[model samples]
Structure formats: C-alpha cells, structure tokens
Target: VQPVLEDLDPALEEAAQSLGGSDWTIFTKVILPLLTPALLAGLSLSFARSLGEFGAIIFIAGNQPMSTEITALLIFIRLEEYDYQAAAAIASVLLLAAFTMLAVTNWLQSRALRYTVKG
Candidate 1:
C-alpha cells in the first residue's frame, strides 16, 4: 500500500487542485480510484492466507476435539483420526471455497481495471 501510494503521480492531485477540486474531492475522484485495485488485491490475499491458517491457531489455542469451527483445523483433526474420507471431503469443500473466492476477486479486479489507462 505504501509503495502504491508513493508510485502515484503527484501531477494527478496537482491537476485536480488547479481545476478547483477540494482535497476530499481529489481523493475520492482521483486517488481512491487509482488505489482500488491494490486495495482489493491486499484484502483478497490476506483473506486467502487467513483461510489456510491452521498451525498457528492450533499451537496457540490447542485442539478441542469436534468443537472447533475452523475448516482447516477440522480437516487436520479428521486426518489425525485416520478418517481419510472425511478429511478428503473437508479438503474438497475448502478447495471449492478458496476457488470461489479467487474467482470473485478476479472478476472484481477485471471490472476495476476496465476504466484504468493502459499506460
């Protein structure tokens, strides 16, 4: 996010200011639009990372059999119990969810990029 902010052309804000745009107007009409793609990318990446988070949670919050609601943890428990079929089913569900999220993010990114200048 910092890098993206720094990479933005100062001339955009300058031009907006010269055109009598207020600071808030310049931000909403100029900066936010430019930053939207990076914001979406950051959010989606963090969400994907959190979805796969298991080891840290297990280590910090110990496993309470059948009580945890986290899918990754649930799959781990099933695997430990030698219930391969159950683990596979749970894994398939997780995979489907992750793929769905990926698809949505891609769709949103494409839509956002539609108005972006190629240069």
Candidate 2:
C-alpha cells in the first residue's frame, strides 16, 4: 500500500498541477475525496475474503469447539462428524454474515457515488 501510494503521489501531483492550483489544495480538495470510495471498496473486499478463509486458518487454528474455530472450518468439522444440523446452522450464519457485509459494501459504494455526483 505504501509503495502504491508513493507511486501514485507523482501522478497525483501532475494532475493537480494540470488543474492550475496549489498542490496541497488540490490534494485535500479533490484527490482525497475521490479516492475514498476506492479505498473503502478495497477494504470491504479484503475483509470479506478474510472472513471466508478456511485452509490457511485451519493450519494455524487449534480447532477447538467454539474456540479458535472459524465458521467455515466449523462447517467442515461438522461434516466430518456427520452432524448435519450443526453444519447447516453454521452455514446459515456464514451466509448471513456474507450477505450483511455485501449489503454494507453496496451501501458505501452508493454513498460514494452520491457524493461524487453532489460534490
């Protein structure tokens, strides 16, 4: 992220200069606001991916019941134990969580769009 920001700084400076204004004013007034949505979207996607991650976490987690177990790993464990009810419950919870996150992301994107249009 730091490297990308460093690379972008030069381009952003060029853009602001092209607008015929001071660098500080252009950055604070224009670029910062415009970048908010992209930053939020990246964060939201990363968070969602982390929530669903199973394989990496499985090796690190102790897999104790209701302890270090993540929802996805819990589902796998339930399947192995032949506990369909518990597996289904955990799956439902995961589904709900994913949906909630998606909804929030959508809302944030919409808000960004509105800001871009109105600002």
Candidate 3:
C-alpha cells in the first residue's frame, strides 16, 4: 500500500487538473484505479495471516475438537491422532486456499495496471 501510494505518478492528477478535471473526477478516475491493486493485495495478505493464526484463536475459542476449528487447529489435532493422511489433506486445502488468494490478487493487480508504463 505504501509503495503504491508513494510511487504514484503525480502527473496523473496534474494532467487531469490541467484538462479541467474537478477534484472528484481526478480522484475517482485516476487515483482510485491505481489504488485498487494495493487494497486488494492488503486484503489478500491480511486474510491469509488471519487464516493461519491458530494460537490466538484457540485462546478465544477453546479447543473443542469438532466445531469452531480453524484449519491449523484441525491439522494439529489430526497430527496428534496420528492421522497423517487427514492432516496432509487438511494442510493441502489450507495451502491451496492461500495460494489461490495470492495468485488472484497478483493477477488482478497486473490486469488492472496493464496499461501503465513504469515511471
């Protein structure tokens, strides 16, 4: 988010202003599109982090085996029970989910910025 914000081309707004764009027009037409990728990336990363945070969640929602189980907690339980297959499956699902989110985030970002040349 910081990099995107810091590296944003001031010329975008300047050009809009020179062309008689209003403040709302410049922000909605120029700045918003540039910031979309950053916002999506942040959301994807935050969700991934929260998904893997089993320890913090465990304290809040006791370690009941069946309900309210986060993927990490479920994997831990399966491991303790020596259910290697189940543990592996659960871990794979979690990994796949995180990977999908990150991949989609990157793809969306690139697609959104496709017309932009590096400044």
Q: Backbone clash tally for model 2? A: 0
State the lDDT of candidate 1 residue by residue for 18-117, as single tens digits. Answer: 9999999999988887788898899888998998898887887777766655888888778899999999999998899888988988888888777555
By TM-score, the better pick of 1 and 3 is 1
The TM-score that candidate 3 achieves is: 0.77
Those runs of model 2 whose alpha carbons end farther than 4 Å from true positions after fitting are 1-29, 117-119
Instruction: Indicate the worst ten consecutive residues by lDDT in candidate 3.
Output: 110-119
**C-alpha RMSD values across all candidates:** 2.0, 4.8, 2.4
TM-score (all chains, Cα) for each model: 0.83, 0.66, 0.77
Cα lDDT of model 2 by residue, 1-119, tens digit? 34435544455567768879697797676666666677777888798888779878878876677788887887888999999999999889888887888798788877766644231
Shift in Å, residue 90, candidate 3: 0.9
RMSD of 1: 2.0
Clashes of each: 0, 0, 0
Q: What's the CA error at residue 32 for candidate 2, in Å?
A: 3.7
lDDT per residue, candidate 3, 1-119, as tens digits? 89988998888889999999999998888888888888987899799789869888899998877787888888888899999999999989888988898888899888878645465
lDDT of 2 at 22: 91
